[model samples]
Target: MNLYLLRHTQPDVAPGICYGQTDLGLAASFDAELQRIRAGLAEVHVDHVHSSPLQRCQRLAAALAAGKVHQDPRLMELDFGEWELQLWETIPRGLVEVWTEDYVQHAPPGGESFFDLQQRAISFFDEVSANNEDLLVVTHAGVIRALLAHALNMQLLDAFRLRVDYGSLSQLELQDGRVTVSAVNRRF
Candidate 1:
């Protein structure tokens, strides 16, 4: 089975502001970016399209899939809660301390931890693999990181090592329960 992972286009959010599952919209310039993405994937025939429930991903997925978008909550970005719209530097000191010191175990107030995200992503991947079909997933950077970690068998806490830029594409192939990463962070 082939998996094509696509991170959403640039969001209409302020710089340095955290926005996870915040239902943000894409920038107006994203129309061109979406066109580029479509052109890049023009050759690979897509079988199914999935997206996070967030509006940012859903909107793009709908357009790309031509209204064939399927909602997958597991693909949602890690919840930021109180830090959802705060600048990184201005975040409460306790939140920063927890995030910097023990991100793996620390969930933001009313939000999810990296560990939590990893579990959800793994579950989602298992289901997708069982289906064994070509799939295009329009999701967030954190979800992309979790997928990378799952494919590579890296520690969940180390998901941050993967850097997925906006509108980037990653590919993975799964066969007989084995996963091989074909590409990562490719933008066209």
Candidate 2:
């Protein structure tokens, strides 16, 4: 089984802003980036295409799947809750510190913890992985990192160290009963 993870292209928002599950649109560079992503994936044989319902990912997924995408809420970005559209600098320093200290188990006010996101993401992954078909998931950085962490049994904190850049591609392959990470943050 081949699992391909692709993060959405740049969003049409300023840097330093917190946006998770906020449903933002793509940036002006989306066209070029999308073209690059399409070119990069031209060689893969995708049997299934799943994507987050957010516009950023939906657009890309639709393009890749030729409008035959399966939208899954579980693939959405982490719910930032009250911090959804707020600038990171504007969020309370104390709250930020607390969440950053142990984001895996700590939930932002009204939001879920990284562990919660992982549970949902893994559930979706497991369900689809049972088919043993090649999959293309257009999702967020958080979900990709969580999947990578789960596959490698790495410390949750260490997953944060893996940078999932916009429009980057990562892959996992399952052979026999073992899963191996074949790529991480690969750009065209």
Top TM-score model: 2
- Residue runs of model 1 more than 4 Å from their true location after superposition: none
Global CA lDDT computed for model 1: 0.88
lDDT per residue (tens digit) for residues 64-149 in model 2: 99547999999999998999999999999999999999999998898999999999999998898888999999999999999999
- Assess the local accuracy of residue 166 in candidate 1 as a C-alpha lDDT between 0 and 100: 90
Candidate 1: C-alpha RMSD after superposition? 1.2
Highest lDDT scorer: 2
TM-score, predicted candidate 2 vs. hidden true structure:
0.98
The TM-scores, one per candidate, come to 0.95, 0.98
Q: Candidate 1: minimum summed lDDT over ten consecutive residues — where?
A: 95-104
Worst 10 residues of 2 by lDDT: 60-69
What candidate 2 gets wrong by more than 4 Å, as runs, is none
Instruction: Put down candidate 1 lDDT per residue, 1-188, tens digits, no spaces.
Output: 99999999999998999879899988998889989988998898778999998888988888888547889999999998888888888887876887868777888888889888878988988898898899999999988888898889898777788889999999999988789999999989
